[model samples]
Structures are given as C-alpha cells and as structure tokens.
Target: MDLLILGIVVLIYFLLTGYVGYVAWRRTETSEDYMVADRKAHPYIMAMSYGATFISTAAIVGFGGMAGVFGMGILWLVFLNILVGIFIAFVFFGKRTRKMGHNMSALTFPEFIGRRFRSRFLQYFGGAIIFLGMPLYASVVLIGAARFLETTVKIDFGIAFILIALIVAVYVVMGGIKGVMYTDALQGTIMFLGMIFLVVSTYYILGGVVEAHQALTGISNLIPAEAKAVGATGWTSMPVYGSPYWWTLLSTIILGVGVGVLAQPQLIVRFMTVKSNRELNRGVLIGALFIFVMTWSAYVVGALSNVYFFRKAGMIAVEAAGGNADKTIPVFINSAMPEWFSYIFMLTLLSAAMSTLSSQFHVQGTSIGRDVYETIMRRKGDRSVLITRVGIIIAILIAVVLGYILPGSIIAQGTALFFGICAASFLSVYAAALFWKRATREGAIAGMVSGALVSLFWLLFEYKKTAMALGVTRVIFGGPVISSMPWPVVDPILVGVPVSALMLVVVSLMTEPPSREHLDKCFNGIKGV
Candidate 1:
C-alpha cells in the first residue's frame, strides 16, 4: 500500500467525520438533544445507528477472528443478533421502553429504570455498574481497531490506540448521542458496502461459494490436535455435544452475547431516541438486513480464510496469526485482499470501532454525570453535561490503558465476558421494569445486586477464561478454577441470569408491590398493549 494513498484516504475520512460531528453539535442546543436526539430521530438513522452500535469491531475483528479459529458454528450468534437483538428488541422491548421512558421523562437508561422503580439507589447502582464495567468492553473495541491498523499499516499499537480513542472522544464529548448516531449512520453505510465487497471478493478468489465451503469441509482432517481434543469437529460442523468446545461456543460465545444484548444500556437507550413505535417498527427490517449482511459476511469470510491460508501458507487461521484469534481477521485481510480493497476495509473497521466506542463512551459518561453524580448531588444542567464530557475523557483513557495491557486472543473473550456480566446484572431487572407490572423497587435492587455479585464471583473463581487470567482463584485455591470441567467452561450468564430472575420474582412477591399510582404513571397509555 502506498503511504501517500493511505494518508489521503485517512485524512478524507477524518474530515468527513469532523464535519458530521460539527453538524450534530450545532443541532444539539439542549440537554434533550444531547441525551436522546431530542426524541425525534429519523427511522433510517435510528435503525442504522442501532445496528452499527450493536455490531462493532468486536463483531468484525474480534468475533470474526473467533470464526477463523472455531469455524462457521459461531454463525449461531448472527441468527441471535438478528432475532433477539433486532426483532424482539425492537418489537417487544423497544416500543414499551420508548413509551415508558417518555412517560417517566427519563433521559438515560438508568434514569428510566430508576424512575420506574422510584429508587435513587437503583439509579446510582446501575450507573456505577456501567461506569466501572464498560471499560473492558470499550477497551476491547479499541484493541480490535488498533490491531487492524497494526497489521495492515505497520503502525505501533499504542499510537493506533490513542488515535482511534481521541477521534471518537472528541465527537462524543461535543455532540453527545446525536453526534454518535449521525456518525453511526455514515459509518454503518460504509461497513455495509465494505462487507458486501469483502464476501464477494472472498468467494470469487477461492472459487464459488460451493467450492469454498466444500474446500473447508475437505480439510476437516487438518483440525488442530488441541482443538480436536476439546471437541472441535471441523469448521463446517458444530463441536461435539457436552464437550469443552461446545460449552465455550454455546454458553460463552453464543448465549453470552446473544441473550445479553437485551440488557445493553447503550442499545436500550436507542429505543428511546426515535419518536414512536412506528420508527422502531420500520427499524426492524433495516436493522435485520444490516446485521445479516455484516455478521454473515464476516463469519463466513473468517471461516473460509482458513482455506486461503492453508492453500498459501499450509496453516490454519489461528496458527497463521501467531496463535492470537484476535489477529486472524486483520492478518487475513492484510495478506489476501488487494491493496485498493484493503483501504476500504480499513475504513470499514474504523467505522465499526468509532461508532461503537462513541456510544460506549457516551453511555459511560452519562452514567457518571447524569445517573450517578446528578442523582446523588440533586443537581442538573450544564454542570452535569460538563461532568459527562470529563467522564468521557476519563473513560477513553481507561480503555486506552486496557488496550495496552490486555493480552492477545482476548478480543472475543473480553466482548463475551462483558456481555455476560451485563446480562446477569441488568437483564433481569431491566426485563422486569419493562414488562412485569408487579416488579418492585426492593426486588429490582435485590436482583441486580445479587446477579452482579454472583456473576463476578463466578468469573473470578469458576470461569476458566477469566479466573485463570486474573489468578485470584489460583492464589486462593491453588488451581486455575474452583470448579470441575463443565462448570468451569459454562458461562456465568447461565447461573447468574436464572438466580437473578428467581430473586426478582420471589422478592417482588414477598415485598410490597409498587404503588398503584406509580404503576399507573409508568403504564399510562400502554395499559392495553
């Protein structure tokens, strides 16, 4: 790749991004605009922004890398991303969340839930969870983009990390959600087009789709000894049932992110951005198509890259990337794609990273400024927004630091871990708040606290991936994990979400129900629905 061409392309992309951020900042004259795009976003922009934010570099570079290692079985997540993330999320959750948010005059997700349950504690607690927990997720996203830059352009990881982080922070701090969404719409379009080209180019290069898939299946005998020992059958098939690989794929990779998306604070807040159910209804089809194209192409191309690598270098994707699953996609693109196409794909990745990071930073900032600080201080106005700007900078710095410190093969693992934690901590309470009229403040608090604690404990002591990495369990128990085989492999969401739901139902039934008046206020116009 020519340095001049790359520099020119990057400059153009940055200028465009800067212009869009400026436009959004100009439009954002009030706190409402900053928080929720003044609750009047277009259907197309809302749908695109939601999909873009939902599918980030984590999906492309991170999970795509996993596909290279694990095979097409990870395609299950694409199904769930569309079904639950888009369909059920928009139809069942989005409409209700929008109405309830408006009814409560809630600006942030924590604020919405807080007002619903009438608890300052829930509000601040939820905020604290986001502020503390989101850095892991955000940092992995930074790593995904930075890793791509490192592979393709030979840029230093630290420099790439700061450049990506700084560009996103500036826009999000200035334009808020409006800025995030505006850029998201533009970025989403680039991602969609780039992915279309990628899949088409990949199949064309390797032969037709049928030939490519058949080639992958024929090489099943080449499965790594370690992978096969753990139940990896082939790239084309599912892992052996009840095997270690099955547990990781089904529990951690699939269900962890699949079911966990419903509870995402960043995504839930998108529901409240549009005007009404009409926007969400329209968003369903657009979001689904975008997700299908983006996820399907990435996973397919990732798995098939094995065929390309084996043919060229006589190695599988993971081996070719030096054992780092996170580097597989970047390495594949750098090696296989033409120089011209590489430039386009680089932009696709940048869009994916910036769109998602912008949302994460915005959520983290608001969680602190509005949910925690404002609620605790009984304050609101420009001071809170200023605080949010400060919070965004802090969040960016934290993510950059983690990007530097985290090890390789972590992109997918980090993404799943954070999603699982969010599922356990927020999914039960968030679901109850939206649909269960009987859910009470005390129940919400109990369920949230217990779920978060249980999930954390499991991650630190039982889950092999995290427990082993942290070494807390090793120090305390003289082993990698405290549990036996299947338990160690099982994702925390399996244990945490169930326990959380039980606590929510039992506590709500035992404690006094929320006041009839408060319930009425919450369910005001949507009672029949």
Candidate 2:
C-alpha cells in the first residue's frame, strides 16, 4: 500500500518533468535556444538551475557520507561554495563571461574560449577533454543516487541507474538547455525543502543541535586506531593539521571541488543563459542561500548521524553502512527517518542526481556537437542539434557502463578527481581569456596542454586513487607511492594549477600580444572606463 502511494507521487513528478521538457522542446526553434535558452532566462530560474546542477548526488550522498567519517570540518567547503563558487563566480567571473560570450557571439563554453583567442585547436582540445573526462564524474553521480535507491526502495542498483539515465537522456536530447533548466528549477525546490526537513528532523531526534554536537564531541576517544594514525581526531573536530588525513580533506576534497567549480563548463555556461548583468546580480542572493541550506544541512545531518547510530546501534555510521562511506547517508536515512519521509527524501536524492546528470549530459553533447562538430568540423544548422542529440545518447551509455564497473567506495573520490582535473586544465586559461588583454593564442594553448598533461601524469603516477587503481605504483614503483615524499596524499590541483598559471603568465609575456581589434572586442562592455 505504501509502495503504491510512493509510485503515484513519483509518477506525478515524472509527468510534470516531461511536460516541462515538452514545452521547452516546442519553444526551441533555433540552435541558440537549444544551447543557451536564447539568453533570456529569469533570475530565479537561472539561480535555481545553477544550484541544482552544482549540488548533485555527489554532494548529498558522497560528500555527506564523507562528513559522517571526517566530521564537521567538511563545513569549510560550504564557506568556499558560497564565497568562491557563488559570490566570486557570479559577481566577478559571471559578469565578464556573459559580456564576453555575447561579444564573441559564442554559444558553447569551448567556443567562447576558442573565439576569444582565435584558436581552433584550443576549441577542439577543450571539447575533447569534456567528452573524455566527464563520464567518470557522471558515473559517480549515477552510483550515488542508485545506491540510495537500492537502500530505500529495494531496487537493484543496475536497474535504478539505467532507468535514471534513460529518463534524463530523453528530456535532455529532446529539450536541450531549456528543458534542463526548467526541470532543474523544480528539482532544486524539492531538494531545498527535503534537506531543510532532514536537518530539522535530525536535530529534533537528537534533542537539539547543541546536544547532538556535544554527543559527537564526547566520542573522540572512540576514533578507530587506524583512523587516528592518519589524523582523524574526532567527528566534531578537524583532522590533525598536516597529517595525511588532513591533506586528503583540505587539498583533495575541499580545495579540489571548491576551486574547481570555477572551471566547470556547465556552470560557466549559466552566465550566458541570461541577458544582462542585472539577472546575474539578482541571482547571487538566491544562489548563495540555496547553496547554504543544501550544503550546510547535509553536512550537519551527516555528522550528527554518527551520534544517532552510536546511541541506537552501538556502531558508527561507516561501520553501520558496512564500511562504505557512500552508504552512510542512505543507511542513516533509512534507519533514522520515518518510513514515509524516507520515500520523500528518496525523491530528493533523485532530484540531486537527475538534475546534475542532465546538465552533464547536455554539456557533453554540446561539446561534441557545437564545439567539435559545428565549430571544428564545420557542420551547421539543424544537423548540429541532431549530432548533439546523438552525442547525448552516447554520453549516457558511457556513464552507465562506468557506473556499473566502478568500485562502490569511489563516489566521492571520483567527483573530486574530475573537479581537480577541470580546475587544473581550464581555470587559468579561462581567467586569462576573460581578464587578460595580453593572453595570446599560443599562451592559452601552452597553459591548457601543460596543465592538463601535468594533472594526468600526477594522477597516473602520484595520486594514490588512480595510481593504486591502475596498479602503477605497485607494479612499476613496487611501493604505495612513486615518490618518497607525501605527494601521493596531496591532490594534483595543488601542483597542476600553479604550474598551469605560471605557464600562462610566462608564455603570454614571451609571446606577441593579441591584435588591438581582438582585445577591444573581447573586453568591450567588461573593461573599466
């Protein structure tokens, strides 16, 4: 009987989402509309869409579970999400991105960067990176949400993953950016309400926020010896500074995603969805508030779940979830919340996963079609959209295959890896393209290639996750690390981003400056009077 009711609710939600996608498809006449919604999105819609895409199943399920193991120190990411991701991104980067995108008459992010520097190679390279790298991240999102469905709904993980991907692909292929943002607005609202209830309910169950935190603090001595050796202090405190655990949290998890948000092609394209600076400004408060409620609540609830599990089951969240941090939040919700709320929150997790996956699929498709096929191969008109739709289908299949094969514990790490690579490869050049008049085509190419290759090399040889996964360290180095130093523990971003930025500056200084007409066109309406 309860399953029937839940089915009805899910059906209604899907019907509404489908209707929105249909409307968007009907409205999408030109390729521009398919790519950027004709650049006329409202402030609220744009803000909600951005928030939805940013806070994915990775944040709620993967990172939330991380909070269960690592504790409240993860809240630093919330600060960065607001300060850097929202404030700096929307105000500083977004304003310039919108003006520059308009000035260049570019539809895709790669196209914008390529046109700014007049480099076809740069454009094709960026598109190829997106095509090759994004599926791993998309797979993580799939696994996170599928794990939740398996836990709460009694569904098989593979079936849930494929079903979710297929449904999202249908809307994305048919509706494009318009369909994506419209559904994102709705999903974002559901996510906000669900997370708000989760936080409040968790506090109520634990007697209050103060009491819950106190209980967590009192359990410091319960830290596993293995965890403590690596720098875990307690669920309520930061890891020991400069410890391997601390490096993993700060450098890999927090810094990777925090700074990496700037270079996300899907998020950057949001700036071009609106017409004027006013829309961007109007979106700042909404985006900030949405991000805060969504992120803060998840972390708080995740950390508090340790208290709840210890009291009820005499086990910590990770132990209770069978040693998988990715399972902690799902286990906690099923055990802590009422049966009905579990079903409702399942929808919340679904919203998180689907919203993010849709955006990723859309971006991947456009990267192949608009950035590669149209811009690089010279395809045009309606055929471009057709190629994009085909690309969306192919991207979905790749993500599903990856989701099926990846280890269950890799959700959070996978998300961080993709974010780190994106930041290392793109952020430096992107900043230069928007703000530096001296940024030449040669300089941009050098920075991008060097940054991307360094990140890849570090991941293969030094970063433990990929190195160990690939057996490079064990097979080649005959050790856990290739270096005697703690390079294995540090994220590639810390090294790659700096090298990339330095290369951008040094190469630009050495190369000839861009033409006067090019600089004027790129900086028009953005430069100071």
Candidate 3:
C-alpha cells in the first residue's frame, strides 16, 4: 500500500513537470528563449522559481540532520535566508539585473557580469568558476534526494541517483528556464506543505511542544560529559556557544548559504528571466513567505526529532547513524511518519532535488554554451540554440561523474565554498554595475581576480574544516589552521567579499570610468529596451 501511494505521487509529478517542459519548449524559438525564457516570465513564476532554486534536498536532509546534532542554533540561518536571500535580494539586486540584462541582450548571469564591464575575461572566468564549484554542491543535493528514496522504497543508492538525474536533465534540456520555473512552482508547493506537515506531526508525536521540551531538557542531567562536549543540550535549545557544532553553524553553514544567495547563478538568473521591476516587486512577498515556511518548518522539526528518537526509541539518531549528519533527516522521516506518509515525503524530497537540479543544470549550460563559448571561447557568429541543449547533457554527465567520486566530508561542508567564491568573485562587480556610475573595466577585473584567488586559497589552506569535510586523498596544506580552535579560520565571504569590494573601488579610482558613450550603451535602457 505504501509503495502504491509513492508510485502514484511520482507518476503525477513526472507528468506535470514533463507537460511544463513541453509547453516551455513549444514557446521557445531561439537560444535566448531557451536560456532566459525570452525574458517574459510573470511575477508568480519568478517568485516560485527563486524559492525553489534557493532551497533544496540538502536543507531537509543535510541541514536537518545537522539540526539533530547542533540543535536550534541553525535557525539563525533560516532567519537570514528569508531576509537577505529573498527580500533584500529582490529589492536591491533583481530589478537592476533585469533592466541591464534586457538592455545588453544578455541571456545568462555570466554574460550579464561580462557585458556590464565590457570584458570577455570576466565572462569566461565566471563561467569556469561556476562550472567548477556548482558540481560539488550539486552532487550533495543529488545524494540528499537519493538517500530519501533509498530509505523509503528500498532502492539502491546508485539507481536512485541515476533516475533522478535523468528526469531533471530531460525537462531542462527540453524546456529551458521556463520549464525549470514551472516545475519549481509545483515542487516548491510540495516542499512547503511537506515541511509544515512534518513540523506539526512531530510536535504531536512528541506529546506537543511542552512535553517535548520537558523530555528533552530532562536528558541534560543524564547526559555524559562527552555528549555535552559534542554540544547537545537536551535537544531543545541551541548548542553550546562556540563548540565545533556551534562554530560550523556560524561560519560554514549559516554565513555561507545565507549570503551566498546573492551570487548563485541559478537564483540570480531568475531576475534576468522576468520582464520588469513591477514583476520583481510583485514577486517579493510570495517568495519570502514560501522560503520562510520551507526553512523554519524543516529546522524546527529536525531539532525535535532528537527527543522522538532518544526517549521513544532509545536510539540516538546521530550517534547510531555513524556520524553522517546527512542521513539523520531520512532516518527521522521514516521513523516518525507512517510508512505511507513517508512515501509522500519521498516524492517531496525528489521534487526538491529535481527542481533545484534542473535550474543548476540550465544555468551551467547557458553559462558555458552562450556566455563562454560563443561570446568568448568561440570567435564567430552565435551558435545555434541546440548547442545549449547539447551543453546541458555534457554538464549533467560531468556532475554525475563527480557525484560518483564524491566524498563524505565535502557533502558536510554544504554550500560554503561556492558561496564564499561567488560573493568574492562577482559581488563587487555586480554591485558596481548596478549602483556605481564610476565603475571601470579594470576595477571589475581586479575584483574578480582578487575575490576568486582569495576564495581558492582560503578554502584550500585556512579553512581546514572544509578540507576535513572534503575527505580528499591529499591535503596540500595538511589541514585547518586551528583544529584546536573548532571553527573555520577565515570564512571565504568575510575574507573575499570585502577584498572584492575594496578592489573594485580602488581600481576604478586609479583608472578612468568607461567613456560616457559606452556607459550609455549598457545603462540607458531602463525601460528603453
């Protein structure tokens, strides 16, 4: 019976997403249509796409598990996510990105950065960086959804990974950005409801909030000193201040994914897909509400799952699970929910992965095929739109290969490396292009170089926690600076974003601004386009 329900839900979701892809494909005419949905997206679709791309299986699976260990401290990240990731992002960044993208005929985020400063170097470098960093994050998301299915349906991990990847690739290759956004709306809805149901049910199963709190707090007196050192305070409140779990929460998981939203190729391109400031303005509230529920519910339920396991089942889910925090969410869902409800959660997890994976695939493809190849790598007339579809296939294959070779530690690091690099690499250039009229090409180049280099070195050497997370074969620098210190030494965003911003200002001042005529070419089309 449980299997039957799961199968039916999967069938409906696949068909709905496929229909959306077909519709999007029918509407698409040229490469621009495929890459950016011809810049004609409505506000609702734009808002949902932003929401879907922002949250993924990693949130429910990896971070949820982290919550089981770290407790409620991770909630601070949920707060920042809606504040910076959605509200500030739309009001501050979205409108201008749309206006400028349309003005310069840019179809992808990398193209936007390159064209804004009149530099192919930025375009090529931006594309390369995304192509490199996104795969690790992408692979993590892939494992997240795959694990849910493996637990619920008794499928093999390898098989689940392949099927999910292929399904996402099909719609993305067929329909482009419109397909991704349409599917995102549907998937985002399921994710929102799934988390809400879990949070509500978790409270009931644990005897509501008050009882759950008592049971959790009671354990504090009974816990071993070792358990306390690892940062469990009766599973009800935040972790011990500045424990390893607390430090990871502050620097890597919280600070990284929250600010990193600004530079995500998938999310940034959503602004470029929509038509006007009005569209972005209308999209803001809907986007914020959806992300808030999705994040808050997941973390809240994840922390409470500890009491469910320890008291009712006598199993410490994290300790029993071999210290792989990513598996704890799946372990919770399967145990807490009925076998049938677990199926619904499985489909929800699948939808989260697919919606996010499709956008990442689409963004990577457009960056490589249009922004890098035709504009920079190739020195001829524009290539056919079919080339991007081909590029999507190639990109997925690369991600799959990396996923197969993926390490357990890198999965734990979540989106930290990518966020730091993006903030450092493009945040300043993006800010200058949108806010400062005195922005010069030299300043943009300097910012990009400084930001990218800083992120690379920091992630490689100073950030020993990230290296330990990767579980790599070789440690060139031997490990993190302060293993004894517990936290990441220099978070890439703190190190790189400031350097990127300062470099942009200093270089722009040292050099002349672009000629007035050139500046007009990029900025004059505020509704003029």
Candidate 4:
C-alpha cells in the first residue's frame, strides 16, 4: 500500500512537470525567449527559481551527509549563503548585471563578460571552461539524487541516474529557460514545505530542540581518534582553528562554495531573467527565507542524527552508511522517518536535484551553442536554439557517465571544487566588468587564464581529494599530495582568487583603458550619462 501511494504521487508529479514544460514550450519562440525568458519573469517565480537553482541535492544530500560527519559547524555556510549568495548577489551584482545585459543585449553569462570586455577570446575561453568544468558538478548532483532513489525506492543506481538526466533534458530542451524557471517555482515550493516538515519531524523525534543539541554535545568524547588527530573538537563545535580539518572546512568547503557562488554562470544568468531591478529586490526576502530553511534543516538534522542513530543502532551516520558520507541522509531518512514522510522527502530530494540539474544543463548548452559555436560561426536565429538543444543532450550524456564513475564521499567536495574554480577563473574579472570601468580587456583575459590555470594546478597537485581522484599523487608521487607546503590541505581558492585579482589590477593599470564609448554604454544607467 505504501509503495502504491508513493508511485501514484511520483506519477502525478511527472505529469504536472510535463504539462508545465508544454506550456513553456508553447510560449517560447525567439532566441531571447529561449535564453533569458524575454527578461520578464515575475518576482515570485524569479525568487523561487533562483533559490531552487542555487540549492541542490548537493546541499541537502551531500552537505547534509557532510554535517553528519563534521557536525553543525557547517552552519557558517548558511550565513554565507544568505549574505553572499542571496543578499550581495541580488543587491550589488543583480542591478548592474541586469542593466549591462540589457544595454549590451547579451544572452548568456559568457556573452555578457565577453561583450563587457569586447573580446572574443575571453568569450570563447569562458564558454570553453563552462562546457568542460560544469559536467563534474552536474555529475555530482546526479549521483546525489540517484543515491537517494536507490536507497528509498529500491531502484538500481544506474537506472535512477539515467532517468533523472533524461527527464530534465526533455523539458529543458523543449521549453528552454522559461520551462526551467516555471518548473523550478513549483519544485522550490515543494522543497520548502518538505524541508520544514523534515526539520520539525527531526526535532520531534529527538525529543526537543534544546534536548537534541544537548545530546549531540554530550557525545564529544566519542570523536574518532583519527578525526580528533585532525582537529575535530566535536560534532557541535568548529574544528580547532588552523588545524588540517579546519582548513578543509573553512578554506575548501565553506570559503570555496561561499565565495564561489558569486561567479557561477548558471546562477549569474538568473539576473538577466528579470524585467527590472525592482523584481530582483522583491525576491530578496523570499530567496533568503527559502535558503535559510533548506540549509539549516539539513545541517541541524544531520548533526542530530548522530544522537538518534547511536541511541537506536549503536553506530554513527557515516558508519551506518558504510563509510560513505553521501549515503548518510538516505540512511537516516529510511531508518528514522516514517514511511509516509519518506515518500514526501523523496520528492523533496528529487526537486532539489532536478531544479539544479536543469539549470546546469541549460547553462552548459548555452555556453556551447550560443556563446562558443554561434559566436565563432557568426550565426543566429532558430538554428542556434537547435544547436543548444543538441548540446544539452550531449551534456546529459557526459554527466551520466561521470555519475557512474565518481568515488564515494565525492558529492559535497566535488561541488566545492567546481564553485572554487568558477570563483578563481571568473569572479575577479566579472566583478571588475560590473563595477570597475578602468578594467581593460587585457586584464580580464590575464585574470581569467591565470586564475583558471592556477586553480587547475592546485587541484591536481595540492587538494588531496581531487588528486586522489586524478590518481596524481598515487601515480606520480606515491603519496597524498605533491606539494611540500606546510599547510597542504588548503583549498585552491585561497591562492587562486588572490592571484587572479592581483593580475587583474596590475594588468589593467599597465594596459590601455576601455574606449569611452564602451564605458559610456556599460555605465549608462548607473552614471545617468
């Protein structure tokens, strides 16, 4: 009976999703409509869509599971998510981005940056990076959602992975950004309600909020010796300052994702989806509230699960999941939550994965077809949309392949890797384009290339997780890291972002300034000239 009920709910969800896609497809006609939804999205849709796209299965499943291992210290990212991802992104970046996008008639993020600098190389280079790098992030999301389905629905992981990729691809290819946002609004609402229940139910099960936290604090002595050696003070407390674990949490996990959200091509393009600055401003509270509930619930519930599991099963979450942090949330839900709630939470997890995956595939498609192929070929019109659809298909295939191969405990770290690289490669130049008229094309290019290379080098050589994935340390150096630096665990963003910003400043000072005409158009609204 429970299986039957779950099936009925899932089927209805698919039908509604397809109907929404059909409506969006009917509305989508021109390239502008397909790319940016004609820049006239409503405040509610815009806010919810942005929130949904920003918070993915990576947050709820991957990071939630991470909380199971690392504890509530991950809550710092919640503060950063609200402050940087929503507040600063919408207020400081959104207004300028919307105006500049309109002034330049830019469609995609790469196109915006490219036109801002008036450089085709930067445009193509940015597009290439998105095409190459985004699949890893997309794959991690796929793995996250698939893992949940595999755990809950008794589905094969490979089958679950392919189904999600295909379902998202169909709507995205047919309806474009309009369909993506339309579906996202619905998904976001589902996610919000589901997470609220999840958190409330968790606290209820743990006896109460204060009592749950107190139980969690009581288990500080249970910290594994291996974890303690690396500076884990307790599940409820931050790691010892400047310890190896602290660097991983602060530099790699928190800072990498917190700072990196600013430059994500998928999220940045959202600014171009609205009609005016007013709509962006209107979304501030809704977006903030949505993000706060979703993230806080995940971390708090994940931390509290240790108490529940230890009391009931005599094992921690990671141990229960067979040492895979990615599996902790699924194990907890299946073991702790009632069957009915599990079904609802399954939809929540699906919404989280689908909303994020749809945006990622869309951005990747646009990067290739509109930013790279169309620009290089000097083509336009309906053919470009067709090419973008094809690109989406190809990207889906690549992400599915990656989902099958990625190692255990990779979902959260993999997400941070992608975000960190985006910050390193694009954030400095992107910020300069928006707010600094003195920034030169040479500076943008220099910053982009240097930042990208430095980030890549650090990941392959210095970051232990990525190096192990690449088999660099094992194959080449026969150890965890190639770098002999005192603090080897520090994330690449700590180094790459600084170097990228410095290069941007020095190169701009040395190079000729952008033309008066370019500056005039770029700052038209802001300077009132």
Model 3 lDDT per residue over 1-529, tens place: 3667667877887888888888887887777678788888889988988898888887778778777666677888888898889888998888888888888888888888888888898888888888767777788889888877787688998999999999999889888888898889888888888878888888899888888767766665544467677664656666677675556667777888888778888899999888778899899899989888888887777777777777766766675455677778887887778877786787779878988899888887877777667776565333635667777887888878877886653454656667767888988888888888798889999998899998876665557665555544135545435344643544778788898989989999999878887778777755432
Error of 2 at 339 (Å): 1.1
Using lDDT as the measure, the top candidate is 1
Preferred candidate (TM-score higher): 1 or 4 = 1
Higher-lDDT candidate among 1 and 2?
A: 1
Instruction: Report the Cα lDDT for candidate 4.
Output: 0.92
Candidate achieving higher lDDT, 1 or 4: 1
User: Whole-model lDDT for model 3 versus the true structure?
Assistant: 0.79
lDDT of 4 at 77: 93
lDDT of 4 by residue, 1-529 (tens): 2788988999998998899889999999999999999999999999999999999999999999999989999999999999999999999998899999999999999999999999988888999899999999999999999999999998999999999998999999999999999999999999999999999999999999999999999988878899999899999899999888898899888998988999999999999999899999999999999999999999898888899998998878788889999999998999989998888999999999999999999999999999989889988778989889999999999998888888999899999999999999999999999988899999999999999999998888778777766877677878878766444788888889999999999999999999999888877877433
Which window of ten consecutive residues has the lowest lDDT sum in model 1? Answer: 520-529
Model 4 regions more than 4 Å off: 473-479, 527-529
Residue 102, model 3, lDDT:
86
Task: Tell me the whole-model lDDT of each prediction, alpha carbons only.
Answer: 0.93, 0.92, 0.79, 0.92
* Residues 58-131 of candidate 1: C-alpha lDDT, one tens digit per residue: 99999999999789999999999999999999998899999999999999999998999999999999999999
lDDT of 2 by residue, 192-222 (tens): 9999999999999999978999999998887
Which window of 10 residues has the lowest lDDT sum in candidate 3? Answer: 473-482
Which of candidates 1 and 3 reaches a greater TM-score?
A: 1
Single out the weakest 10-residue window by summed lDDT for candidate 2.
477-486
